[model samples]
Target: MKNWIINQSLDHPGRTVLISLILTFILGSGLRFFKVEDDMMKLLPQNMESRKTWDKVKEEFGNTEMIFIAFGKSGESIYEQTTLTSLWDFTAALEAIPDVEEVISMASMNRMDSEDGFLEINELLPNRELNVIQLEEIKTYLDNHPNVKNRVIGQHGDFLNVIVHPIDGAPNDILAGKLLDEADIYLGAYETHFGGAPYLTGVISELIRNDVMMLVRAGMVVMVLILLLNLRSVPAVGMVLSVIFLSLFAMTGSMGWIRGLTGSDKFLFTLMNTSMPIILLTIANSDGVHVLAKFFKKFRQTGDKREAVQKTMDALMLPIFLTSLTTAIAFLSLIFAPIEVMTGYGVSIAIGITWAWILSSLMLPSLIMMKSWNISSRALTSTSILERFANTIGKVVLQAPRKVLMSGLTIVVVGLAGIFWLNVEVNIQSFFKKGTKIRESLEF
Candidate 1:
């Protein structure tokens, strides 16, 4: 198999390159149809009872997701003329947005007054103003109605809240954007803050988007720096980075294809893109580095790129294959985690790892065969700090085998003893770095 792949790729580098490009283009086109799902419940498995029940409820009642907006003023009662006017206008503006099923606020609340033979429903502040007597009466009534008081009407009438319930299939980000845009127009007189499921989803989705771009770029920069420092060859670094880049493209594009064909949920798209690239890059580069080192060693000895790559493949295929398999299995274990998001993450990441392995195996070798890729032989011969440290350990192990063995046993025992101190706690908020808006909002 090794000899066949080498011959096939080396014998027709142009054809190999053309085929690879065509396949990549076909797979990558799937990205045009990719959808991003921001709902946390969508991450749960479809067969889960909780998910089924939630879906049923949503279908029956529409999306009961509320967008809560709070209004506050400094050193003034919410019943004051300015605050009440702003609140009334804000409530009216929010009610006009499409898909907003209902808006509940102090301005919109119904006050029920029971008479001798009938009941009357009237707006709590019908005129948005009150005389002293009317204020006392309304306050008394609000104090008796615990459900409405303090929730929409503040205890001291110094704050108010508007709850907008959206209809089913409402676009969360667009709705949130509209609400904020309207708030900027209508609630400029008061201090305003937004809280609710829709707002949280919007905020989280934005954070994930920003994190994907930042984290992937940062990971690539760090990977490149490390590769350059260790390999000390521009061609070597380029070959490794190319494999990583192609692997990421293939993994993401294949996910798009899967989603397009099956109409799968987009739960894994952003989350996986945010995390899997860094992990796949590292894993892809590890195998590439090992293969490159072997190839370089052979080439330094014999000065033949094709022969060196072939010999390296023959020597390292089994070991690299086993290493990738075991690493993939370790990631696949997340499928058993209780959370549905973990299961999605596990499947997506495992697929990415497999893709990375395939790309590295085929493309990396093919890339090497396309050129001479000569490098200074002194790279391997130099005694860097790492080499000196490794030599010292070898000397100690050889000269004092019994002592080294005892020390190793002691270290293992100590490590095992410390294992009991480990604790299992999953704080999802901690996943976001401090000083981020999402983390701050969650903490708040």
Candidate 2:
């Protein structure tokens, strides 16, 4: 197998490159179909008891998710006439939104009392404009009805919360946007915050999309810079980047293909899977770097590009294949994970690693054969700073093997001990930084 690959790459380098590009393009075309999965419930185990109960609840109650819009003023009461007017207006606007089943706020609530020994129920805010006495009456009613007050008002009477319930299967993202727009129009002077599962779902979806684009681009840029510094050749860096890009394209595109073929969203990208591209970038780059470094060293010795390519493949092929295989197997272990999203993450990443190996073995070698490298005697004889640094570390390890072993063991021991202190952050809010709008809204 190795001889066949080497021969094809050397004898018909163009054909080999053409085949690789054709395969990459065909597989990568599916990228347009890729979609993001932001529903956190999908990440949970389908058969879990809690999950089953949640599903049952949703089945009976129909989208129990609510979007809470809280209005407040710093160091002031929400019972003022102007604040009450704005709150009433905001409640009406929210109720007008499509898919909104109910809107609960101080303005929307009913006032219950006894008039002429008969029970009476009337609008909590009968008019948008309230007099001073009417404002005090509302305040007195809230103070008496603690349960109702807790639902619509803040703990300290500083904020009024409007809870909105949307119909089942409603698009929360669109609805949240409309709700926020109305809040801006009606309660622009007051401090406003949003919460509840529906609002969070919408915000997290946008964040996931942003993160996928930003992190992948950033990772690619950083990898290119590092490759340039280490390889010190534009062609060499390009070859490595080609493998990385092709691997990522194949990985993401395969997801779309899987979903299209099976009609299942199980393989869709999720927050947990966001790191897959970065992982592939690092691993794919490693394989290409190994091939290029070995080829360069061999070419310096033999001064024959063809012989260097053949010998480089012969020496490193088995080792690189085994490394990628073992890494993929390690990730494949996640197939047994309870959560469906994690299982998908494992399978997708495993496929990515396999593709990376294939490209590094075939495409990279073919590219090396096609390109002409200019290697001066000075360049051949002189070692790079990275090589020197590696050599220095090798010498230290060889000179005091026992001391090095002890230091490594001690570090591992400390890491093991530190596990006890490590906290598992399951809060979705923790995904955002402290001052981020989403985090602040959730905290509020």
Candidate 3:
């Protein structure tokens, strides 16, 4: 099979490259359907006891998700007339937003009082503009009713909290955007912050999108620099990067395509998938580097590019295939994990590794055959610093096998001991730095 592929690629390099590009384009187009799954509960196994309970609660009652907004000016009491008026307007604006089922704030509360042996209930802030006496009466009522006061008022009267409940099935990202926009318009002069599970989930979705793009770009730049230093050829680095990117597109695009075809949320990208691109990039680069290194040596010996490609594939095909297979199988083990997200992560990454292997074996050889090389004498004869470093380690192992074994065992033992003291945190807020606005809002 390897020989057939190698011969076909060598026999018609242009046809091979064209076919690969066409396949890649068709798969890459599926990227248009990609989406991020931000609901943390969706990542858990559906059949788990806690997950089942949560689902049951939501089905029986209603949307339990809450978004908390806190707003006030520093050194200003929320009981002031202007502040109360602004709060009233803000609450009304929030209630007007679509999908918002309820908005709870002091402005929306009802006051109960006894008069002439009868109990009566009235709007807490009946009018948007409250005089000083009316504001004082509301403050006194809050002082008597600590539960209501604590829920709506912040510590030391520095701020007021508004709690919003969205209808079931409402999109969190859309609701969060609307809520923030209203806050900016209504409470623009005051200090406003937001925090809640729903809000954090939306924030996480954005962060994941940003991180995926940032990390992949950074990884590619670093890989290109490393490849240039080692391969010392612009064309060689380009060939390797092409394979890497195609494999990435195939993997990510397959997720979108699968979701579209199956109409299932199982394949949606999760926080766990943020590392997929970098992983595939490293593996694909490894295969390409091996092929190029071996081909360069063979070409130097035979002075024939075609012969070098054949000899390189003949020597490397089995070894590279086995390595990729073993790595994919290792990741495939995650299918047995209890978390649904881990299963998707495992399967998607395995697909990526397989794509990398295919491209490395087929498209890389075709690319090599098509590109004319001006291999420097130094590149053909001189060993790179990496090779020298590997050689030095090999000599140490050969000269002192017992010492190397003891060192390896000692390090493993230390790592095992450290596991006892490890602390695990699942809070999304913990992912951000202390000074970040999201982190501060969460803390507040």
Candidate 4:
């Protein structure tokens, strides 16, 4: 079987290629059923005190979607009757979004509009009564509360508050974008007075979405390119990506299966789906890089692509097997993470890494053998700095056995000692770099 994939790949590249495509399409389709969350509140931590305070404020008087609106006097003063009625209507319109919890401003304050009691505000303001005198008196009151004055006037002294909230149930970028979109339109009607989170959430959603998407996309591209660069053929990349795609599909499909078997509609693992692909890819990276590197190096030395493929597997099988085991073990280490996010990350990545390892060993090699190694591209060429460094290290280990062994032993001892101390000193805050977005948001 080790001899089969590389030795026989030249014989039936077509069939291998076809099967790979079919598998990819199936996997791609399967990934669609994966549901992403839309609730933004998940980004906030419940246990943290500052976040709790922020949440309390939101619960009391903030709309997660529509944040703020303002009214003020300028020129002759906003105390005029016309300005009062106009601002009241806009406030009423904003209260319409079902997800919206609250909106506040001087006009709204005077208007008596309500999320709980809309008809009451309507009666107070009336259909035609412009509450100019009342509004003027309110403007006078605002003068004393200068802290919120900018939260209402202007070129010289206007009101503004930068607001923040997790979009309700906005776990994914698309729906978060929708909430921001709706909020931005509201802001436009109310001008800068109502702006804050509208565009910000949209931008943040796009950034997080695009960043994650880029990582997954770029990883796939890089992995495929790495395969192609080594094997120098379409089929090599095809084989690797096929195996990866299959393993991921099978894993995700298992999720659907689990839900079906349990009769649960809510996918418990959904939160982990976004980064699971990348974690699997990261796990695949170590084995893929090593195996393919050795394969191509052998091919280069032998000048027989078939022999090279054979040598690649023959040389690396034990190491690759060890790598899979270690990778899975490394991921399992995440179980110790204190936070729930880290716990989910660890579990999913552990499964994914194991999946990648299995796919690499089981699927890619099998496909390679079935394909019989006929690809139309140049052979693996020139080693650059990394290969040289790897070679230098390999040579040092091989030539000086006693020294290498002692050094390796010492490193292991140190690593163990380090882990012991690390566990003692470990703090969750450290993994998150100093002043990270999560931290900054918390501080805000």
Candidate 5:
């Protein structure tokens, strides 16, 4: 089979390249027809008891988790009478924000003023003339109470968060940073202390976004460094990156197609976050690297660029095929997971591994055959590592064939037995990392 690939590539490398490209454009484009759902909840199994309970609870109360906000002045600014007066004026303006159900402030509380005495509680005010002394007295009261001194204002995001409940729950989203921005502008504008739901939401939100961005960027940087360490040439690295992007493009396009077909919600984006991409890259690129490395090795061996591709394809084809099959089967096994999101992730990546396998095998060889691949001298310096590893594996398998088989079988049986005996408990809460706002929000 390896000899056949070598011979065929030596004869018509261009044919290989052209046919693969056509396939990529044709069937790859057909993925445009698939429809998938993105709603985060849809990813969870409908059969679960907790999910059922969660859905039931959300239906009645309309959602009490308000978008919180808080603000603090820089100096003794709130101590001044002018600042206190401005806060009263700004509180009146905040009441006009759209969709506000209610606004509570010290000044807005109803005043039962009498000539001899006064009492107060928050209710609609009765129209009456107030003397300057009376308004000043209210200002003094607000200055002393830290609740008002720590102003609570609802801004746009809180308004949105308050409004956009899923009739169940939203995808864990960042409202804290957005709340902080609004609090900063509103509090700074009014020259008053502000503290409430929005401020709290913003602090929690920024922490989440920072962690997500950090994890993703860190993964990319690490992968790039690995590639550079393996193969120093920019073009080689670029080719590898191209394959990665190509797989991603195909996956995203297929996801979009699924969305169109299913009329699914938007939270699917949350499910794909990072783990799925890593798995996709690991499986797909592992095959690609095997084929590419062998191709280069053979090319150096035969001193014929065209023959090198065929030789590489011949040598790497079996391992590549086996790895793809095993990876696909492993992913397909995840259909057994009771979680819907896990099911979606498994299905998406399983399909992606297949596409990556096909494209990487057919297109990469063709691309290499079509163009001259000149590598830098430094990174490829250690084929001995791959070679020695392969050699060691070969020797061990050859030396203890029966022992290896018995050992492997014994281990598998023991592992299976242990797994059967183990008791496990799991839930959606496990998916979120510790110290996350989503958990905090859920608890609240």
Candidate 6:
């Protein structure tokens, strides 16, 4: 069956291209469903004790993430009429946001004071701007009530806090941006700072977005450079890059389709998704190098491109299959992790690596077969840098076999020892480089 497929590809390369294109189109269309999520709880196993407690709390509280805003005026009391009015208006604006369930600030907070020996509950600050006497009275009341004052007003009565409670299932990332934008409107008159889970989620989501774009583009550039310098054949580089691209596209689209079909609320592989393209690129390019090297070596012996491809495919079939299978199995081992996030990571990466192997076997060979033999002929005659490096390594290994074996053993032992000292820490701020907006915002 494998030989027959290779013969078909060699005989009718156009048909192979057409079929690959159709599959690519179908899979690529699913990319639109891909989304980035930053929620940490979703990545934990459903039955994990911490996750269970979080779910129960969320159930009772209807989304426990709060957007906390600190409002303060430099060298002045926040209870001043102008600052109070701005705070009131900002609170109203926040309440008007679609996902916002409640906005608690001095505008909506209740004040309890004794009136004629009976208790009177009223808005902390009246609706209208307060005169000097009223402002003094409010400050005096705040000083007397330590519990309310400490929680709602800052230590010196210079800052007021506005807490925003989002509706259940509200997208915190989107809501964070809305809250920041609304706060910006009132920030001209006061120094406003934002914190809480929603803001942090939004910041981390942005960092992930930036990291994915930068890393994927950079990885491709590095791969192209290495392939061109080592292979010294444009067609070979093109074929390898195309295989990598298609493999990534298929993996991403497949993930999106799965998420959409299952109606999964949480994106289980947020970090894994960001890193998948680079991983696929490395795997796809490694396979491509092997295939192309074998094809060139065979072509040098036979001087016939078609015969060379057939021989290369026949020679590599079992080897590539076993190599890819072992790697895929290694990745699949992650599925056994106690955390669901790692399971998602393992499954997605394993599938992606498998897709890369399949594409390298089929699409890459098809592309090489379709290209002109003139470009590939020179590849066979020339001494590529990679070949020279391999030859040099082989010579060194032969010359000092015992020394090389001892060195390798020492390195492996050191690596094993280092594993005992490894530590795992999740510092969200470390996700972004220093001086970045997200990192600065988090620190501030």
After TM-score superposition, the amount by which residue 309's alpha carbon in candidate 4 deviates from its true location, in angstroms, is 3.9
Q: What are the runs in model 4 whose C-alpha is more than 4 Å off?
A: 1-33, 38-90, 111-135, 141-157, 160-179, 186-207, 217-275, 300-311, 333-338, 341-343, 370-389, 399-444
- The global C-alpha lDDT for each of the candidates, from Candidate 1 onward, is 0.73, 0.85, 0.87, 0.53, 0.55, 0.78
Top candidate by TM-score: 3
List the candidates' TM-scores in order.
Answer: 0.82, 0.91, 0.92, 0.60, 0.64, 0.88
Which clashing pairs does model 1 show?
none
lDDT of 5 at 338: 72
Kindly list the per-residue Cα lDDT of model 1 for residues 263-360, writing each as its tens digit: 75642564544676677778888878877767767777777777777788888877888888888889779868765556545665666677666666
Clashes of 5: 28
Candidate order, TM-score descending: 3, 2, 6, 1, 5, 4
Top candidate by lDDT = 3
The sequence of per-residue lDDT tens digits that candidate 2 reaches over residues 1-444 is 889988888899899889988988888777777878667888888889999999999999889888888888977988888888888888888889887999988888899998999999998898999999988898898899899999988998898889999988987777878887898899889888889988887767777878878988998888888766666788888899889989999888877777777766678777778788888889998999999888888988898999999999999989999999999999989979887777768777888899889888888999999997787843355666776788899999999999999999999999999989999998888888999878899898
Q: Write the per-residue lDDT of candidate 6 for residues 28-119, one digit (tens) a residue.
A: 67667777777866666788888889888878877777878887875677767888888878888998999999888778888898899999
- Models, CA RMSD each: 3.9, 2.5, 2.3, 7.8, 7.6, 3.0
Displacement of the residue 414 alpha carbon in candidate 2, Å: 2.9
Which regions in candidate 3 have their CA more than 4 angstroms from the true location?
73-75, 117-119, 377-382, 391-406
Residue 56 in candidate 3, Cα distance off native in Å:
1.5
For model 1, state the Cα shift of residue 404 in Å.
5.9
Tens-digit per-residue lDDT, 299-402, candidate 4: 56776765666667777766777877777788668656544344445544565566666556545555555554433335455664557777899999889989
A best-first ranking of the candidates according to their lDDT comes to 3, 2, 6, 1, 5, 4
Model 6 segments more than 4 A misplaced: 32-35, 71-82, 127-134, 156-158, 188-192, 263-267, 300-302, 375-381, 426-444
Which of candidates 4 and 5 reaches a greater TM-score? 5
- Model 4's lDDT to the true fold? 0.53
**Candidate 6 or 5, higher TM-score:** 6
| lDDT of model 5, residue 426 | 60
Q: After superposition, how far is residue 9 of candidate 4 from its true place, in Å?
A: 8.1
Decide which is better by TM-score, 2 or 3: 3
Question: For candidate 3, lDDT tens digit of each residue in 255-276?
Answer: 7787777766677898878998
